[model samples]
Target chain A: MNNRMILAAVAAALVAAAAPAAQAKDWTHVKVGIEGAFPPWNALDPQGNLTGLDVDLIKDLCTRAKVECDLQAGEWSAMIPSLNAGKFDLIMTLGINEKRKQVVDFTVPYASGVASFIVEKDGPLAKMPMTGEKLDLNDKEKADPVMKSIGEMLSGKAVGVVQSTSHEQLITAYFGKDVTLRTYKNSGERDLDLKAGRIDAGFDSGVYGATLPSKPGNEDLTIVGPQLKGAMLATEVAIGMRKGETELKEKLDAAIKSAAADGVIKTLSVKWSKLDLTPTF
Target chain B: MDFPFLYETFLTLIAALPLTLQLAATAIAFGAILALGLALCRISGILPLDWFARLYIFIFRGSPLLVQIFLIYYGLGQFREVRHSMFWFILRDPYWCAVIALMLNTAAYAAEIIRGGLLSVPHGQVEAARSCGMSPFMVFRRITLPLAVRQALPAYSNEMISMVKATSLASIITIMEVTGVAAKLISETFRAIEVFVVAGFIYLAINFVLTRLVAFVEYRLSPHMRQPAPLSAATVAGEIR
Candidate 1:
């Protein structure tokens, strides 16, 4: 406790100390941060090098933007705080949402994907109604009945969610009263519990929906429930930066647009996640 | 400094304080019994018991508490039989899992403290008690235990304070203790600084009371350590100094 307190205090001090150093930027060198754990987005390889869709996408974006970028891997929790504290200039594979926009700015979304639940292949929720279907949460006329049925299916059952993700918020808002929530620090931990039957199902990215079931140890898992987007569930992925960095935001936004126009995002998304996540926007 | 938000955060955190205190109290209480058992085992002179206690201490003490927590919570679930066992009811709840982890971790550290206190019992004191026709158990009960506690009080106080702080780690397991609530608040609001400040203050306040309570206990145990009562200017009779 003492150590963390002192470190937070020291970080605040460093932010203050580095304030003057932020006078003006030439935009030649940019420091980018990634979790390096979220597979298909950004992750470390066996050789301890960063690789994944976000890694590849960032490289192309930086090249088009004509900025030299340095990539660093860190814990997910530290990404935003470190960015706000000036430790990193940009964070990759960030999901854009209103709650997050209050604290940081985001470039135009470069990729998009739906979120859904994963259950044991033989579990009661394995073939829930609306499975293999997609629903826009904003389209309440079509979504309401499906969501109500899904909620009924989840009632009294514990569902696992990764902490701080939009999925956590969505589940809480939609089924907070009916379902028991078990928040995890990461999807992998949540998966372990789900496989163990400690949780009835797990809510996560479509990448997990697409990739996790085929992974070695997760063979029994199957994606269930409707693919959900819009509203609290942020499907659009963007590069997060400290709020008010207009110059950097403009440069990155333009780069992201260029990359999307070139099919780079769609190509890399397939290479990493095998899902074409290029956003229509 | 958003005073209103800080105050609101305080209310939210304070509401969760009982859980934080409950975890600490439960851990400290049960851990004390476990610690006493291990300490006895360590000093009981039976080789197997001593080695068993030593091994228990070595493992729990050596590994990080977070790993132990994950092991007990997530690791144990990996075994199908354990999940199906009758004890699964107890092991299934995250609350109990956290309690079990906290209790075991504290016991390891407290065991050493208890052992040190027990070993600090002077040979002459035990010898005197034996010469006074007291049975070994009586000697330990009336003399050795009391003196050991007094000797161990200062160091033991530090352990108790740390155990209070250690309860914060239970947040990771989703216990919604003070730290847990603060974390969720930060994640939702993205206001890390205010939430952390509030949470830290909650912990600080708890430990402050804990230290004062421990100090009071120490004072009561050490009547001899107090300064002699000041001489009264108003004398009674002739026997006054």
Candidate 2:
């Protein structure tokens, strides 16, 4: 009986030791999925590897969260499915939209930005938006008139937007029949088409538009039209986690809150996006 | 299927048809020429020529076409010299890059098919041609090439349908082909499975038409051979042991 007790104690101790080790490793083994082509957010450099703002942001967030992360570059359209399939634990650089809320959970908004139209600075449709202020799509009064003015300018014009994005939805929702909205699989290709004069304007995030001038032949392009934000733009960009990842979400949310409180977010936002994307709420 | 949306999807995919057709036609046309050259080199009796053809075929046939497309589009785009060189203008566009990858891949497979066709030309036929005072070129042009192509037609048609399916991958590089448009439609609606199914059906219809066309061509070319009629149950049973 005494020997049996001792054996039971030993087994219990061994189980306790192994349990903590696995838990500790679980926090360390983070697989981060990113859409590598979404530029300034995440993009591939000359080495044909992933890079950019989200790349930097993910490293910073993981370091702050005290986790070792493996960044996996995935095609944008398949990112969500890949994440759900357990190919990765987190999706780093996607906007927190209501539609996505049905599928996945998100951390607190790490960054907030607007979507805008990009057109040639000297092109015929350049000066038409005429509004200098960003438009909040949440308000119908403002959204209706603003969309009308934007539509008039966009009439008979080719607008390029990335597939499976709020920008594409916005273009289709507001100006479906009025304008020719061309969707691209990635922003890189749309940017190329814009530079090649195949597209009159491309609608993408303002953050991405800001980096367009840095591309080889896009020096002539400029952000035009009203910057669409708020409801139509989705909630904000956050670290997306699969639904049911409650603990992980809490951990990320806390880390994000701590980062924001420490001004790390503001610093990084200005450093990467060249603008203060620090969330107000 | 939502009738309106289905109709819209068809119209949208159809609008993108020109680009898809252009990609397939251009790739197959160029690939056929390259295949012929590679096939000849493969069987040319010269060791260097055979080795060169083998390596070319192996490299292209071994790797996934997606990797090949990416290497051509983004990989080659990485080099400063490639960007500034005369070929940069062509390489800069995703359309041409996709075409180049497709052509190269098809050429590798097509070469083997053509080579098989060439080998299928019986020794008796060549011997008979030579016995009739036919020169080598005449024998090859009339007997070998024709016989080889006939033998290769079935396999080549499979390749042709595969090429059509392969054009779907071009969407990754951002060409607004049928698959690209379908992806966009799904993104807006979030009905991925539906849109993809519709897109797949379009490809199926295209392949179905192509299969019939190839069958027609096969029948026209092989006039000397008699095709067996559709087998009745009795006929099938009679052939069984």
Candidate 3:
């Protein structure tokens, strides 16, 4: 063959060899990624297998979706990158947000969430206004007063958070100038500082926050202030995958919808978090 | 290339560079002093002192720097005595806690470097200094210290660069160093590769300048090792005349 024709034929052969892998994707076999350290949602058992709400729910969703899925536990920071790199077909417990949307598409939210503060039980911050109350941040009229009061109280105080979380954004948006912010790589690391009194308070998800006090030796930590949702804080979490994986997304979306309708999420939520995390709509 | 994003991230990250430099400088400076004492302990013929220094070096070098940082920052405060003690004011601050950890960790490694430098000073040179009517202190001050420092500078410079990199760990405790800001940016943007590339460049630039400065110091210190400067043409002509 002439040189030009030879090059064209080689390129065509390469494309032909790649097209089947792209076009004939199978949904029956799937791989799911999850963060095993985020408690109540997911964590490793003593025997070192992943367990908890996300694990249990994923099993339900995969059954309903009719996919025999293999679950992988990994670092939270690696989730989006790994999924887009094709290491995973889905990532669990990803809170839906605008920034993440640019990189990975999300399944329908399967769990509703909230944010709150935890402080040493003996600290003055433990007596914050609206303790044991629910404050919907979207209702600015009611939230504004409480937000102002919490801000003023926390002024010049250091607050700790796990970096990059939705509640971290909410804390910066509401109390950026008021509180000294300390971002950590993970919750366990941040919790140590909070216990040491290096940080005056810690902001975390309500699921995480409410559960902290009950952990042994965390008796001195009290979850105070309102369970907060809306604004920069994400109120719902979902499975995420690369954008345009339409077939897999549809399969997950349908499974999640049915799981919610059948009360699977509510049952798992109460079992794991000791609270109802069922998404409203 | 997202030049704008990189430029903005650089600005944000550079704002924290002063803190990074401060952490490294304080740790290196204080660590040098501690390391000198530890090195002397090893060379001093006293058995107890030598063993103490050996034990100190072994403990610090064996453990991870991150664990040491956490222990000093958080582990110490666990006891009520630490909180109530007069030293609590310094221990309570994250900045000081990081400095203490970095200093202690560097001292262990730098001690060996200093010890090697000190040992390399020939016994004949010391005897010569002593015979020159110089007092013991004067001999060490004028001859031994200078030669030992020159011997140590190359290895010590590596320790200093590593110390600079170690300052990134201070971010875990809330000091707004370069790595801390880069981490926050990554979390906000979810653009790990881009932000990481920018952060890596910043460290490379810092260490580049640091390496050059160390080379300059070594050049000045080892003037005897340099080839003599070439005479100008007029000077050569005068010599010929």
lDDT for position A176 in model 2: 89
Candidate 1's C-alpha runs over 4 A off are: A1-24, B128-134, B224-241
lDDT score for candidate 1 against the true structure = 0.87
Q: TM-score ranking from best to worst? A: 3, 1, 2
Docking class of 2: incorrect
Clash number for model 2? 0
The parts of candidate 3 lying over 4 Å away from their true place are A1-24, B228-241
Clashes per model (N, Cα, C within 3 A): 0, 0, 0
Q: What is the C-alpha lDDT of each candidate?
A: 0.87, 0.82, 0.87
lDDT (Cα, 0-100) at B69 in candidate 1: 91
Per-model interface RMSD values are: 4.3, 11.5, 5.0
How far residue B160's Cα lies from its native spot in candidate 2, in Å, is 1.6
Ranking by DockQ: 3, 1, 2
What's the residue-level lDDT of B55 in candidate 1? 100
Rank candidates by lDDT, best first: 3, 1, 2
If scored against the real structure, what TM-score would every candidate get? 0.90, 0.69, 0.90
Please give the C-alpha DockQ score of model 3.
Answer: 0.38
- Model 3 has an lDDT value of 0.87
DockQ of 2: 0.17
